[model samples]
Target chain A: MISSLKIVEAAENSGIDQNIILKFILNEWVVPLNKKELTLDEEDIERIKLIRELGEEFGVNDEAIPIILHLIDQLNHLHLSFKNNYCH
Target chain B: MKNPYKILGVKETASLDEIKKAYRTLAKKHHPDLNPSNKTNEAKFKEISHAYDQIGTNEARTKFDQGEPGEENSKQQWSSFYNTQQNAGRYANSYADQFGDDEFFENLFHGAHQKRRAQNQDINYLMDLTLEEAVLGVEKVITLANGKNLKVKIPPGITSGTKLRFAGHGLTENSGPPGNAYIMINVLPKAGYIVQGHDIETELPISFMEALLGAEIEVPTLYGSVNLQIPPNVSTGSKLRIKGKGIITNTDVGSQIVKIKVVLPKKSDPELLKAIKSWNGKYDYNPRGEK
Candidate 1:
């Protein structure tokens, strides 16, 4: 688990604004595992990295983030289902 | 305006579940987060979203099928409603009053950045690895486009298409922080080995005498060569499994499967041929089961 300060550091290292990460959390784009301490896991880090990529690389705006995130989640679910059914 | 059913890649008479499934599949494929944004994918995403909005629910589908004015008008009217609902808590004034025009509102919702900050561009680096390196892991020193060298530690058991990210290793901005670097792993194919999940499959060639006499021979694995006992009369294309000799992951260990291939000698001695002729007359064995 990583703290919010560590997330901020990671955001800074990745050229993302700390405030933007906080705003994403506030907007429910990236929810922390522990709401009070704001602890994050590896999955949350990956999600934040993706969010940063979408925003900085793809120029996706805040309004479309939720939609894109939901689509990505659905895609992952579909991929997992297929893998479970066929590959396993 | 495109047809909703065509945009979602479903028939007009498709059920609600079919429509939803199609929409989810297409939306996942063309989602901007997963893919790099281009004109075609962006347009396709918009079309899909619009189609879903038009016919996502049973009521909406029925109205759309009926070609009613109420549904069409309601679709156009929802833009302002969405803007107002999305921006209600953030903005003091209504979106219409603040933006003053549809063009600006659309830009604000889609592309316009509220607070402009100088950000370095993220870099994607392609890294190729051999099958052995991928299974055992390796350390690689890569030189970036900017002439800087970075040493990367690749974890063991990494599959192809895995990505490793290095924070703050990309281009540096004058005002803001540096960007990140991503290493995309590509595993090259190896001869005589097929990777299936964590397990590995390889063909083990054996002489016809060895196959008939059940000889213990050394077979190659990822770790090293190990001795395997072949049963007598082992046929070609027989599979032999060596447990715990495959690619190792965090949770489970895999097996190495060896496919047996029986090889006959190119030239047969006259004495051996004569012996075989005598043996054939003695057994009267018909492998084909011909009467």
Candidate 2:
């Protein structure tokens, strides 16, 4: 499946504002493939959705978003490392 | 839908300032954004916001006092709480300090995208190894979180709880260097061998006849099986040392200590019983010190 999406497609697919997606990209929370072309993968779309929830639903500010995203990413990495290394 | 005054820990006759103070304190304490991993805190935050909405404004307080249900402005509660966080100066100035508040969007989109270096996060993992594998070096393939396979070589004579660090093998960042990965080793004990420091202790079971008469027998070592000589009339619990047969590390070489155990037949044979009975009176010996 073609999972790579352009910035406009990502905003339409995720129902997030284009400006907000740009902010997320600038924050480096959701890294796209080409900064100039703004090509995002599926994981980037998921991160954009999470960022939206953190803002609109949880009332998180822009300053706190990066910190929360970093912590969540660290937790996910640790869990994945454990799962992959166990019983092999 | 509990009592608003009770939930906010204020009286029905509380002033606006008092109500606002209580609501801000409770909302900040239970904010879901701050405590992201806590579901209880999120639920409590919602409840606190609901309570604040019930009697937050003077008109709402009056309506509540006049026996009317205070309108539940859920969206308004979030805005107020968010504003409260901003006004309280918790993380207000940090955003402005990082990127100028007025020109943040302009600086972000325009040619002002300056690259900044941030510290990468380090990660730790647990690894299991056999006693032999720890004594003798082995190579392992570990799959990282990024689905990359990393080959790690564990040095010989590594004990349990030894941490091996792999540089730049942790989480990767867009602007910063990747973090390091630590693999902690837990060495599982072998069935027949017990490792003591640099030495290995193993038990060898010998026949009763071998114990009575001198015999050369083969014993297992870390390197391979070797001949071990049992002296005549050897007793149980006797220890024989085999030099340089245990662990071999870079700095040190260890020996293997073999403990002897004499095994008697479970069922008694008639011929053996007869021979023992004939030799019993001639021996006239009591192993115990009792007369």
Best model per TM-score: 1
Model 2 chain B scores worst on lDDT over the 10 consecutive residues at: B84-93
The numbered model that scores best in DockQ is 1
Model 1, B162-264: lDDT tens per residue? 7677778888856667788989999999999999987999998899888989999999887789999999988899999998777754334578999999998
Best of the candidates, lDDT: 2
Native contact fraction, candidates in order: 0.00, 0.00
What C-alpha root-mean-square deviation, in Å, does candidate 2 show against the real structure? Answer: 24.2
Candidate 1 lands at a TM-score of 0.46
Interface root mean square deviation of every model, in Å?
Answer: 19.5, 22.2
Error of 1 at B147 (Å): 2.2
